[model samples]
Target: MKIVISDYKSSLNFDINYAISYLRDTLGTNTEIIVYEYNGNNKEFIDILNDADALITGYLEIDKEIIQSLNHLKIISIMATGFNFIDIQQASRSHIGVAVNQEYCTQEVSEHVMSLLLALNRKLKHYTNDVDAKGIFDYGTTNNLIRLDGSTLGIFGLGKIGRSVAKKAQSFGIKVIAYDPFISEEVANECNVELLPIDDVLSESDNISINMLLTNENVGFFNMEKFKKMSKRPYIINVSRGALINEDDLVDALDKELIKGAGLDVLVSESPNLDNHPLVNRDNVIITPHSAFYSETSILECQRIACDNVINYVNGNYDKMFRLINPEILK
Candidate 1:
């Protein structure tokens, strides 16, 4: 069996050479892994997947033409939780199963969510900047940097990462509440998180954390109207897909003080020309370059599970753990 890997840059941070070795070892000698840069090059992609039995994609979108060309393809494995880049209906029609690596970095992202919250709550980043320039100006002096001991934490999505956030945040003695339509009430109750609607969560939360996947139905979910509903104007943190929140609205909110502040590790696009971006000059807004799941152990785990999915497909084992969106195509 032949396995091809492309759209690696869509992932941006994944090491292709590491992926290649993992592919070679997992599938053994009968299977080969091909790495191609996915840049809308149909000819190149067609050439690479000409004899491919399975294809592993990173970030690049595999459209209908590409799906049609996967004549011998059994699986389209993506190395991330989101499948918005993949055309699910087309893949379903093609009978090419789509899989994603979802389980590997739940803790990593949740931990980073906590990290961002704590850094903001304790004013760590602000004081670090002050100390960098001179010394600590005054203790707890960055515009009412608050404590999490008796706060209300509102989690947007109550998936694996959301559950992780809840359990961990509860340790800080914060009341955890969640708003996930698909998640069960039992699950939220077990996590000690009160399940509420988005509006109420926005209105009452002291710290708001978003971990929702970005879908067509959910893109730009947090815009001017939603921001206007924020009664408490809590500190916001986004460790998931950037497309879930409106960058311009967030900037305007910071500019106009719509919310308290935001600690963002994700944004709509990788580089939306930050020089001209409105969030660039804000003292309250904090940004990380989409690195919520970037710990050493978590990365190794991601590659391991990603490679496992590819190999399981090669071995005709259709029960990979991390397949998120296109679950029905397996049949």
Candidate 2:
């Protein structure tokens, strides 16, 4: 069987040889591995993928049209936890299995969430900018600062990363509450987190953290109306998908002081033009280039898990697959 590793040589920042060697060792000498470095030319890569039996990719959008063209493709393994870029419904219709490495970056992402939350709460960017630009070193610049020990942190999703964040927040004496319908009350009790309705959480939180998975129903959900419901004018921190919040609405919220501040790790467009971007060059807003899931250890583990998923699928070891998005294809 032929397996294609696309856009990995330079884009993913990991050695392709490690993945190639892992696949070869498991599939024996009969396996054919192709390392294709995608150069933003989808048409060319689609033509090459037509003959691939399996594929491993990072953040490539495999739409219905592209999924239909891959005649021999049986499985796709994503190196990241978010599989919204892939057309899972179309792949399932085509009898193709889709899987993701969900366990690789839980700690890194949760830690990053804490970093952003603390930075926004303490006005680190605002203070540093004031000192650097104007040589002003006054501690009385902002009087709204409050200690996190007694503040409430409302989490939008109580998944693995969310639970980890809750644990870390509790260490700082912060009260934790969450709004995830899928998570059981028993699980929330075990984490020492209060399970509350979405509206209640929105109205009562001193700060908000978004850790939900992106879906069609929740895209652009955190707009002006939602921001208005924030009675406390809480600080917002998002380490999740950017499309979950409307950028225009976010800017309006900041301008109107509906929110204290925002720390975003992802944006609607990965390669946004910064010259005229509203979120850029703002003291109340902090944006990172979507690097919350990066660490040397996590990078290696992500590649290993991606390769293992493909190897397990080839060997009919479906039980060992990590977070298979489409399991009906196996039946």
lDDT of each: 0.79, 0.90
In angstroms, the error of model 1 at 184 is 2.4
lDDT of 2: 0.90
TM-score to true structure, per model: 0.90, 0.95
In terms of lDDT, the best-performing candidate is 2
TM-score of 1: 0.90
TM-score, structure 2 vs. true: 0.95
